[model samples]
Target: MKIYPFLKNLSLVYVLALVVSCVGDPIEQPIGKFESGVLIINEGSFGANDGDIHHYDPISGDLQPNVFESANARPFAGLIQQVRVVDGLAYIVANTGKVEIVQAADFRSVGAVNDSKLKIPRDLQVIGQKLFISDYGPYDENWNNTESFVAVVNGLQGGAVHKQIPVPSRPEGMALIGSELWAACASGSQLVVINPATEEVARTVEVSAGSPHFFVQFGANWYVYAMDAERVYFHRINHSAYSISETISIPLANAIYNGNFTMGTNGDVYIITTSGASARVAKVSIETGVVLDAEYFVGSNFYGLGFDSSSNTLYVGDHAGWQGNGQVWKVGPSGSLIDSFQAGRGPSGFLFR
Candidate 1:
């Protein structure tokens, strides 16, 4: 495997300048219409904590290392778990128990949405004009803290969290439909539905044959392709009834699972995982029930997955051990590893900036 060279080392002095002003071509200036850029979690606090977001340059496939584009985080945390961008603002969800709002242009702080009321935030999504954030509550696996909650902030209401709701158990990921919210509970193995307008528990839908972990909506159905350490489970959802659509065993003697994914324009779903103790990116054909292919990612672990909708450059977060170095891989549409750039630690969830 040929290791691609980085355009600018993190040690380069003009890297930040290069990030703002393009160095070549018949035309200069970063060539991306916030059409859908990526807000990546590059690094975090020393011990698996909070991270920052970058305006991922996918056309050229590079991580523009910025000095000030971090979450308006409070000094020290483990990792910035998830983030989503809409209307030129990056909504960064920090697992260190904070939600930050940063300007999309220069990546600076604007405001923050935190629930000192409810702690340990996990995933977030923007639907219509509202922001729905999921709280993982407590870390039962690590015995950290295991309660679960959800907060609905009306973006129309000045990003004001108008409602705070509770769920049956801890949430790993979530999906939204208009005014309805659906979250996957790690413990209950149920997708709990909530109506933020009424702050009421509406319904509970079971996902997969086993437990559901992550979800994304494509076309008319919401697809929850999840893993519970041993197997990969796929569920095809059409609003109400969802059944185990497919089940495939991952080829790993000891699989280190990371809960993040990206869906292609053609409805194919991608999950980043190891191919038997080796760093590889696995692709599944959503239309057909098969593990289509796997690409080498050149790292120990991956966090978030981002794809440039137009050019189809795949961006992956390189989280080696939740600390020290974080790198982002740039892979071509055909799963060819091309280049990479150093990112932050414990990077999870990415939004196209």
Candidate 2:
């Protein structure tokens, strides 16, 4: 009778252990505060060495400023021009001639590409294992970027310059369409296409008579916006033909010159332009080639524009004339301001996860 009770207790303990094993740890670990949110890239003052990033949570409506310097314990030197996230790392291209790489989730500085050849680097594009940096080249005696080129880095982790492919002047935003890498020369009216395999200029497609600055691809077409002394031109390029298919011009009086733009999920393009201290967003319909709203959303010194497809929201950054802290406004789909949060100095761009 004593042995019977001992056997029963042993069986109960075994069942309890089995139940504990079946109830394992959480299926997913909680993500970092900066991991699943919008990253506001503040270019900072040109000579202040205060370039930083701000994290914003759309769900909680919370803003965390200076996340980059807080995570790395050091200020990000130089003007942060643009940030591109590939795989899980963020390649931050600074105008002061370097590309700083960091973890996209935590903003930890992991590596950088500081080749001496990267002068006034503007943007970054990665294809496969190679990183292409668009540099304005060193300034001449007259301060002209006449030797602009794209520097190629072999790998992301501790990588060096593999080669420098010469392109048109002041290459800015880049896009990979089909198998070719297209770069918009911000100082010329040319869209330079490069062959990634050979790291050479494949060809140049002439756009409207202006400086091509940015590209956004929707469907089988790529939309590019260029600005000249008189007006701004939006060119729709047929990817298969590799040529400009349509050109829509916006008078300078209506929409000023700006390179910041984004394509919405509905195939519409939203561009940001500044006039004096005030900025505006112009909406253009890709199907009809018409400017839908000349001043869809207006704010003070709006310098950055991004469309979040998942939430159908528009995020605009007001740089505050580079005088102090900037602000980011979240606009609804109907062009109504939902909320605004204070960001870092010179908030010029945004990356939404």
Candidate 3:
């Protein structure tokens, strides 16, 4: 068929458009300076109001100090306890009874939940639009956390306190399994389960090991770790029954009660243990329920533990006695020391993107 010059040009343009559409648009580069890096939560001196956030670029090996203050033009006013990134925002729970909402990508302040009911807020768990915060409620005359509760915020973005559900003393780490919200009561031997739909305590399971502080989920089961003076106990709870199915105890001379624990990519549990002044990472096999390595990664003053499943790297934080800048040790998958980088004061937790 004979074709005019204009018609031939139109056919070429249409083919070019079709090829471009099939390939799709180019992948956009991340614009935020703090995006695509590890965020280090610095507890900074308690009550000193020096709490800060540090950003470390794993690919570039560049550490950006005080990214929170740099982005907001003001220092974080409370002791940063933990950070949970949901959607595109970071909910920073602080010991100062406040949860600061910031842009996860840029570390910019967006909103905050400063309710009086958040007495010594320890951890945060977001279920849909609700934000559940575990708090070690106000202390009594003897300086005991006798009135611990979970403060529920109605909205995800710095909403007002919807209710405060009372629970055992010293509630710490929390998790949402199925439909129930399980909270670890660090001062007592109980794992309180709350029905998020009703925002009330559904039941409490007594953990004989006591001081259940953290949890790790592997496959269809959930494991919680507790510590006593002589041993560290790992209890596997049945997801449907909400009861402990198995208990694994690992003897230890001196075990720190910090809730620094994480699950490796292989479904093994890694916890921080102390030997005199040095800190060690203990690995526990999920299948064997035995101590795989009592000293997986050893270092000094290891205060926080986080595992990056993407790279199979373990990030251990060294508080340096709460002195100047802290350090984060990067351990390889084979339990070998890879590298260490300086972070903010009292590097307590990590958030990897």
- Give the TM-score comparing model 2 with the true structure, all chains together: 0.88
The positional error of residue 303 in candidate 1, measured at the CA in angstroms, is: 3.2
Ranked candidates, highest TM-score first: 3, 2, 1
* CA lDDT, every model vs. true structure: 0.64, 0.82, 0.85
The candidate 1 region of ten consecutive residues with least summed lDDT is 247-256
Candidate 2 lDDT over residue span 236-336, tens digit each: 88767878988877665434454777888676878776677777888876676677887889877888888888899998888887888888888998899
Q: Model 3 off-target regions past 4 Å?
A: 1-31
> Against the true structure, what is each candidate's TM-score?
0.75, 0.88, 0.90
Q: What is the C-alpha lDDT profile of model 3 across 88-117, one tens digit per residue?
A: 889999988899999988888888998776
- On lDDT, the candidate that comes out on top is 3
lDDT of 1 by residue, 1-353 (tens): 65445534543656766765764535745733433456566647545443555556555555554423433334424456665666777666777767777665655667777656436777887777777788867667676444677877776223456676778676768777555777887667777887766767798776545556777766776667566665566676656543344454343222335456778767666677665445666776666656677553545666667776766778877776554767777788788887777776655556654
Model 3 poorest ten-residue lDDT run: 251-260
Error of 2 at 10 (Å): 16
- Candidate topping TM-score: 3
Score residue 151 of candidate 3 by CA lDDT.
93
- Order the candidates by lDDT, highest first — what do you get? 3, 2, 1
Winner of 1 and 2 under TM-score: 2
